[model samples]
Target: MTTHLIDKIAWIHLADGRVLSTRSHGRDRYYLPGGKREAGESDLDTLVREAKEELTVDLDPFTATFLGEFRAQADAHPDGIEVRMRCYESAYQGRIQASAEIAEVVWLTYADRHLTSPVDQIIFDHLHDQGRL
Candidate 1:
């Protein structure tokens, strides 16, 4: 059997013990507001670009801090497929709103972990354990 990996990046914005999450158009689960890196793009570049595209905000690369990497079975994918998320926490400029493919923007607590993807649920657990959620 072959194991497949879906590499992705995510912005972990926390406020008042909740995390920022986004639901893409027609999608049922909310995800952190970031995406895969494009060719030749560094993690910061992908983070900034994805944040702008999805949430209408400019992430200050200078203020970005590495959170941690998380992996879990990719939601809706077959067995042996997993998603690896590199998460970062950063300061941003501008108000957040749904843009691009995003249909909704929400703040979720640990209790709302069921509303997110498998990888995001792991992230929620991590945050909760750290007393940040």
Candidate 2:
């Protein structure tokens, strides 16, 4: 078996034990709100840009903290494609509204893992075990 790596940054915004997730245009599953890093962009830079693009919010860099990294099959991609998600917990400004390529914005609890992608399920489990989701 072979695998292709797709690295992405994810933001975990928790409020009342739920995490913020997004459904991109034409996508069925929900995913953590963030995207891949661009050329010359730092992980933080990717996160900041993605959040603004997908959710219309401004992340506070000073309030950003590394949560952890997770890997799993990219369920929506081809068989060999895998995604490694680097997650961050952060505080942000403004209401979260779906924008750009995003179709919907949702807040999910641990039991809602079934609605997310495989990689996000891992994140959900990890956050659940830590009592943060």
Candidate 3:
């Protein structure tokens, strides 16, 4: 069997014990605020752009900190398809609201893990175990 990998970047913002999550237009599962890197774009470039496009916030690149990378079966994809998510935590400017392809923005606690994609569930677990969520 062949295994395919999808590379993605994500922002992990925690506040008041809840992590930020977004549901894209017409999608049921919520995911962290970030997306795939464009050609020749660094992780910071992708993080800043995706944050603005999806959450209407300006992430302070100088304040961005690497969290960890996680991998799991891609949600709604074939059995051998997986997603590798590189996550970061950062400070940002402006209030968060659904923008661009995002349909909704919500703060999720550990108990809400079931509503997220497989990779996000792993992220939630990590945050929970660290007592951050």
Q: Estimate TM-scores for all models.
A: 0.97, 0.95, 0.97
Lowest lDDT sum, 10 consecutive residues, model 1, at 95-104
Model 2 misplaced stretches (Cα beyond 4 Å): none
- lDDT: the better of candidates 2 and 3: 3
Instruction: Identify the candidate with maximal lDDT.
Output: 1
lDDT of 2 at 133: 81
Clash total of candidate 1: 0
Cα lDDT tens digits, model 1, 1-133, are 8889998999999999999999988889999899988999898999999999999899999999999999999988998999999999999999999996898899999989999999999999999999999
Q: Which stretches of candidate 1 lie over 4 Å from their true place?
A: none
The TM-score, computed over Cα atoms with residue i paired to residue i, of candidate 1 is: 0.97
lDDT of 3 by residue, 16-86 (tens): 99999999988999999999999998989999999999988999999999999999999989899999999
The global C-alpha lDDT for each of the candidates, from Candidate 1 onward, is 0.94, 0.91, 0.94
